[model samples]
Target: MSFRKTGAAILALVMAASLPVAAFAEEEKTIEPTEVTFWHGMSNTQEQVLTELTDRFNEENEYGITVKLVNQGNYGDLSTKLTASAVADELPDLAQAYNNWLTAYTDKIVPLDEFVENDFDDYEDLVEGYRAECEQLGFIGALPFNKSTYVYFYNKTMFDELGLEAPKTWEDMLAVGEKFMEEKEMPAFGVDDLAGFLEASLAQNECEYASDEGALFDNEAGLETLEYIMGLYNNGYARLIGEDDYFSSVISTQRIGGYIGSSTGVSYITADDFELGVAPLPTNKKAAANQAGTNIVMFAQDENQQAATWEYMKYLTSTEATTEWAMKTGYLPVRVSAFESDEYQSFMADDITATAAYSQVDAFFPAAMFEASNAVRTSVNTMFEEVVLDELEPEDALAEFVQIINEECDVE
Candidate 1:
């Protein structure tokens, strides 16, 4: 080492030794100027809002953190890239993540407990369901980004004219469809996600979904869930997106009574000549609905990088930012305060679709995150297709499903 540098280091150490330990300990913490790279898969209006938020943070943050966004296609493309980057230790500082992907790379993720508690002022305002879902590996490893839940969107005018109310149970749904059968001369009920229908229906019927052991939805409740879904399709009462690629297509044609879809479906739907209304999914054994969308996760990095990345994470989830995001995008706000804010209150007053789904946020449930979670989700979709579209017996399809998932998700 250079003599001058060595002498300077020694002198600095001597100076530090002269200060009282208590005084040094009391010094305030500070952040170094940092450039945080964020990876995400948001597109369209979602992408525009994300950029606006990032630009605002870059311009307004006191910590001198410059956040550069890396837009990585859609969620599927993002997941494929993340799988490769994680193994190579080349992950961006932070990225949007699914719990399954986060589970797959738990060792590489940085827990956010410290930041959630110490740096965030609105920690207590976060919705409990999303907060609970973020607790991974016994610590907060991710934060809800663009959350949504299944909601029943109905043509209020037609429902009222037919003397039908928003269904309160599976029985109510089947009974109400009869009225639509008389008028529409077509299937009036639909669900956008059959896999979601299976999972959420199973949970509602008091059946466990899956776990480290194996697939759990092979019991009576599981059979009943499949039978219910099959009956809807076979009876010409309901359809799925897979069946016809329909939802907005049907709604735009004014041929739908109602459908179950993510709250974000509000963006694509218009009631046309009918008055639109949204309501929580009808319940059976429980009022459970499956939550959708992803969260933001940070990778393990140097202390400065971690701190700066965390700061941005905290900002992204703050009440003001989340409220503004929900107003601009169709996503549900993650914070209760954000939803309660006067601006959002006014927004929802006009946007009844959002208001209805927000009422069921407490009922939202997350799927299990395991090594083979993504694969199992695909299998569930296949199971639905086999039973509903291909006319496979529910029990036989379920048996094959259990075997495949047990082999794939059997964790060590």
Candidate 2:
């Protein structure tokens, strides 16, 4: 199915008509320089690029805004700190947040509708998929920042030597995986996130993991998805890489032939001794990939800080900045204009692996959302372990899993 455009249509309806002329004409108040503090979870190369860009914005922007970025380790740490800050009434002016974290602070976070309606002029330039992702829950909770999608990473050296082609469907994955297991005496596919895999697999079957009613993965489609995965494990064709780096395992061991993982991790997939190939996730019924990454969310602060935060947000997501981000990092650009830019074209030309993700952009979908989204994912992972490692029947495991998630989410 085509990527859902309903969110975009709703946003257009809510933001299309310009406000009264007086509303636009009466904005001449001179405010003092504002210092907007930002909390983020970037480290290493990503942190370096973000700091460079923030410094440029501070020194060059027309608005007198000084952005102070505080790296809070990884996303989990940032979310925890943000929660504590919320309780202490000490939240930063802005921070990078995933949908689940944003949902937790929805009441405390400021909606960008008024700011976008009045200040930003290039809303249409944003990629339709990323824009829809921002508005996935019926409103723009945050602006798209570093975005990525899932891709199939395979050992091209092995494929060529074995005269094997990349799998194009679930059946193909099973057949290829079984062949590798029998011939090579090793697992062919390794996955770090079973929940993410389930999301993609469900979408292929035209199903979803959650709904307004409750967890929806207890049906025939969900069973088939789990059974397919279990079949691979039972036959020694697949393995879950728990507490291990997938890329490193794939490279160091050189046992597994391929796996489905994030495009953001592509940079770490070094293959000096062999050839590494990246492709879109294998399809079953329809082509679908789960969109991954955090968005820049603004907390409700004073008017000046809010204004400054929006300026920085716009700058970060601008075509030029996003193109730079995509070039430096493995993440996808958040803007359609960025993808069309000469800079991005050159970057993609040099790194064909990065281009694999862009091809699946049209099929990207917002990940499953709920108040207890992370918890639900945890339960799904647990179920995967029970079924794959413990060898529990798919139907029995799914029944218990559905009950647990529905109770945790308080679904009627």
Candidate 3:
């Protein structure tokens, strides 16, 4: 069967079994609607697409559920506000939350396993890796929302002009950047998130930043990762997009020949003067890319509101909806069914750049999922700045940062 036809068949079966026929028929007689509030960090184009999808769900779903989406600026701001709301007992019915952020409110969030098993027959269709990442403390704490993986975004025109192939490993990446520096007199690579870059690089070297035991990135592999990145910075072959935006460094300045960034950022990367190319991040001991993005968490609400929220959540992650989302934004589809859908295939055919993230899905892994994950990321980022910008020696900087993170993070 065709991908679309298969999805449609499974969806029909799942929806038929989602709610009891007698209960659904009786509920249809109710005149009142269940009002659910959703707080999200989406803005600009992403927010627009989400609003359209949510509106469609509100209108088409069998249940009378009205979702009021409140924009919470960026993810960091949303995290802060959500934490405060949880304390005040004023949390929204649904919110976009990372695993670390969700860990802080375990008591206030509803586990999704019960709803998934009872209400959705196609729950097994969710991508296995995504499902595993969402699982916490024996229950699915959240559902994947706007997931993404890192990819190498390069200026194809520059590479073609120099007769250089895209880098496939860390050593090759530096060599390519050095060649670009010598030939074009500009840095060849820039990274928007140093922390994420470090995580992927460390994974390639079989190292973890931290675990329940403590910090694990202060060893040989970590030192090598730092030294190589700092070498590029010292040689004027690379730059870090600290406070400044990635687009400004790459597009506006035209100085950065390529960058390692989230695939979702593809829409923001403009190459009016050059051909843009997207590839999986370079590997070393192993192929690895950092998996990221928010998940939908349902708060502790009344039974009716909880059911309504689950319906919307399941709808958001449905094959049709996820395919539309991946096509509209450059984010990865959360379900395997979406990947197999004809709609996604057509969209990928038109612009393969957006699908670069999918190519790395099998190799993608999450960072530390504990509450201290954010602190570890901050420490690593600061360590990068100290080594590259402040000229701190790699070994000394790594040691100092590891100590700081261990003290601050209090792992286990």
Q: Best TM-score goes to which candidate? A: 2
Off by over 4 Å in 3: 1-32, 247-249, 410-412
Ranking by TM-score: 2, 1, 3
User: Which regions of candidate 2 deviate over 4 angstroms?
Assistant: 1-31
lDDT of 3 by residue, 1-412 (tens): 6999999999999888866865786755332378899999998889999999999998997778889999998988999999999899999999998878866778888888888887774877876667777885458888989998778888889899999888988898889988998899978888878877777777888878776556788788888876776677888778767567664356444667888877887777667888888888888888888887888989947887887888889889989899899888778898888988888887887775656777777787876666577677777788777777776666776777678678767753
Task: Kindly indicate the candidate among 1 and 3 with the higher lDDT.
Answer: 1
Clashing pairs in 2: none
- Across 4-98, the per-residue lDDT of candidate 2 in tens digits comes to 58777767766765455346647753345888999999998999999999999999988688999999999889999999998898999989988
For model 2, where is the 10-residue window of minimal lDDT? Answer: 16-25
- Quote the positional error of residue 365 for candidate 2 in Å: 1.2
Candidate order by lDDT, decreasing, is 1, 2, 3
Query: How many residue pairs clash (N, CA or C atoms closer than 3 angstroms) in each of the candidate models, in the order given?
Result: 0, 0, 0
Q: List, residue by residue over 1-412, the lDDT tens digit for candidate 1.
A: 6999999999999888867664754674467899999999999999999999999999998989999999999999999899899889899999998878755678888888887777677676888888878884578889899888889888888889888899888888877776688776666688787667777888889888787787888789988876776667767788656545658667656677888888887778766787887889988888888788899999949998998898898889988899999889989899998988999999999888788878777788887766677788888777666666766566776776677778778632
Q: Estimate each model's TM-score.
A: 0.89, 0.89, 0.87
